[model samples]
Target: MMHGLAETTTGALTLEHIGRRFGETLALDDVSFSIRHGEIICLVGQSGCGKSSLLRIIAGVDTADSGRVLLGKTEVAGPDRFVEPEERNIGFVFQDYALFPHLTVEENVAFGLKKLPRHEARERAAAVIARIGIETLARRYPHMLSGGEQQRVALARALAPKPRILLMDEPFSNLDRGLRERVREETTATLRALGTTVIMVTHDPEEALSAGDRVVLMQKGRIVQIATGYEIYDRPNSLYAAEFFCPLNKLPGVYRNGRVETALGAFPAGLNLPEGGQALACIRPQAFRLAQPGEGMSARVVRCSFLGEIEQLAIKVEGVEGTLHMRTTERIEVKPGDDVRLVIEPGGVLAFPQA
Candidate 1:
């Protein structure tokens, strides 16, 4: 519907061997990844995992100790060259929405267009404000705007300049959970309509998985994996990557004849572990479904908790120690001490080499 979606330009962003250090801490280590033009990338990791630090380096706010960053064929940062943040044609939306307190929404949006004529800057500001559907707040100052309104204003200001790339660091984190979800949907739609290339940093896995075209998962200053939401969740590269995105029911087992046999069932060992090696079958909570009596592994419902659309369940199976957590969206008619049968839904089972 929007013509802007087809207006993606050339100039893929490429990072080569980027590394940074702070005192004794290695913040970023040889981090290398490429983003296609107009692609939305989300950097996700735990605190101190270098996601934010990598973003700063890409925006030219923080310099890398080694390696180079290339926009298309032009080098932005390297051993021989360094570009200032403003001159890099990159827009940054900080987590706190850094709007000028003394200026109105329109004025704040127009501040970045200082190089243009006064009328032209005002026109661009008004056009961006209208496009983002926040023109009604043009005359209002930051103090008078709500958290969501301020976030919209910040986005409008960032997009006003029509930069080559946009970087956001947890832009929706300040709002309430419901508001955050709404704003995220709105922002994603707006970015897609404008065909803006974006690199967003988020600590929340749901935000990362939902909003990103591709997710970059990092751990301890190193990149763990890079893939689409489905691939990252279903075909994780490591145990850390698997557990980072969702909770897994790790069942201990032994690898034999290309399968890991656990007390629950046998799962294809996706790893290349030697025969008779220690392995684990990682099953997601939603992987278990209700089965008819005596059809699958027998499990006892230890507890059942209603969680709106999805129900959380603690199940106990014979020959396996500890309670296995399960989640289901179906209106399962069960309670504690009820006998139940659970069948493992195909594709939710993954085998990993035990550490």
Candidate 2:
């Protein structure tokens, strides 16, 4: 939980000890979590980490090998209980923005509301179209609309039934980067305005951190951590978790007292390692500050490339094991083989026991 972001006391969705396997590979192992009403939770991980498998189980498209899933008072999945996909009232927006080319935008939107009268369904679709600001696209077919328009139609169809919850599996992966950002903003605003409870699955860490109220990070079919973006990025539970978000420079040494010696010189790392105990100091690239030649830790620039507002560089320090990767916005007249210096901020270093 994060301050200023109050989760609903009422459990909107809950997964208890969920497990699934594909042949010899475990897809999900003992995964459990609770979601509050109107909350947006992102399930994020690397490829083949079982994020999609978990989403399928939650959507009722696939069955879990173990444990239970509940939405409000409805027992959606359990050892002895199972609910069909349609009956669960979960709206899924697929990665491809699955829309019907044969149907008009209005017809597509109305498809999910078939339980309502034909007239009532059209009315609901029209209202949702207006809400999506795509009323003008109501009569257009999927091919007649742009990528963003088609996505809006898909989203409109999903929301037409006023589902208990919405499940989006990388819904924005299809569009171009620019269009994706715009559509994401629009979709997020609409979901929040309608107070919809959403559980989305994506492999992109940036998307998970930017759009989720809480991020559920998965690794090898197991949840490593679940927290707000800030907490997960800054206070990772493990080295694996830390490296998942960004690259880290590892410095190996032995710890004695409270410091870990590294190529960059020793700084305080509160690890209580006995003398001669192994330790590894981890530092993020952005933590390095540029300094005048010989004024700070010495290094030789091996590579530099301008990246819009910042420059990406690879530098080699005398005692560091590998080339250090860093990104900085500071203007520096340096190229390959140029001597450079950098200083690590006080809190930039984190020491852990050598694995």
Candidate 3:
């Protein structure tokens, strides 16, 4: 579901009932989502999960076997209509940057302005280079520039065209962690300043959370959940979504009489579920707090690992089958084989159907 007032005030780019296939394998399966103008939407998923395929469809680089893509009110792709990539006026920043090695930065940036006179093309390219804060490297070749510099040059080229939309296909995948972080922040700021509509595909969760106005979690070519980072983390709709977003410790539980009974204790079941049915409940490490032996559920510390700021403990309850992972900020004094208690906060349990 779409969130916030921006989605309603501004019309969105819509993909309706999109489906694509490659022989016997399905790349996209009736996937649909909307991205509002001036909003940055991130498509995130595992490898071979149709994230890139969906981006290509939106860019008009590939046609869907069935479905419609609408930009504002215009139908860009559908059963009877298909817009060519060049006609779509969408800027694409590839993973590799794809700059011309032989050409200077200015020449490369001006490649898309072929229709304009040479003087006008150079003028526009110069303006964009200045806007991206890379005017000093106007005469340098791609190989002469650093990874971050080359990325900026590529962005300048894409922004030079003044496209109605910008599509980035894993743009930060090639850079190191430090460079990726800096470039992403700068690029996001640039896009925001221009109020550009952008769709970025990335496998990195941190990047998706930091760069996107909205995160669209995809799986098997279908949209799972579209929400802000906080919403997705706090209230994941399914087990798959929750586990994909972060590490989760799931335990067997039963929903009965409007309550969920687990190893920890019986708690009020907030979600609607059939009574007397077995379900899986998810608890994140941060959701639990350490308690005194008699204050909470009794358990024994099976293992502990120091993770810099926080300490992770693997605890085992006497009757519970699986180990429960817990994280604490303070250095825990407990050791392996030491009996401790785990207090499952009533608000942290997220239960789903067993199937």
- Candidate 3: TM-score? 0.92
Candidate 3: where is the Cα deviation over 4 Å?
1-12, 333-335
Which residue pairs collide in model 1, if any? none
For every model shown, the clashing-pair count is: 0, 0, 0
Per-model TM-score versus the true fold: 0.95, 0.94, 0.92
lDDT scores for all predictions?
A: 0.91, 0.86, 0.86
Query: Is 1 or 2 the stronger prediction by TM-score?
Result: 1
Write the residue-wise lDDT of candidate 1 on 1-355 in tens digits: 2111222243568888999999999999999988988899999999999988988998998999998887766678888788788888899899999999999999999999999999999999999999999989999999999999999999999999998889999999999999999999999999989999999999999999999999999999999999999889878999899999999999999999988999987887657888899999989999999888779888999999999999999999999989999999999889899988889986788778988
Please report the TM-score between candidate 1 and the true structure.
Answer: 0.95
lDDT of model 1 at position 316: 96
- Model 3 backbone overlap count: 0
Off by over 4 Å in 2: 1-10, 270-275
Query: Which scores higher on TM-score, 1 or 3?
Result: 1
As for candidate 2, its clashing pairs are none
lDDT of 2 by residue, 121-238 (tens): 8888899999999979988899988888888888999999999899998988888988988888889889999999998898777888888899999999999999999898887877
Best first by TM-score, ranked: 1, 2, 3
Which RMSD values do the candidates have, in order?
A: 4.9, 4.6, 4.3
Error of 2 at 300 (Å): 0.8
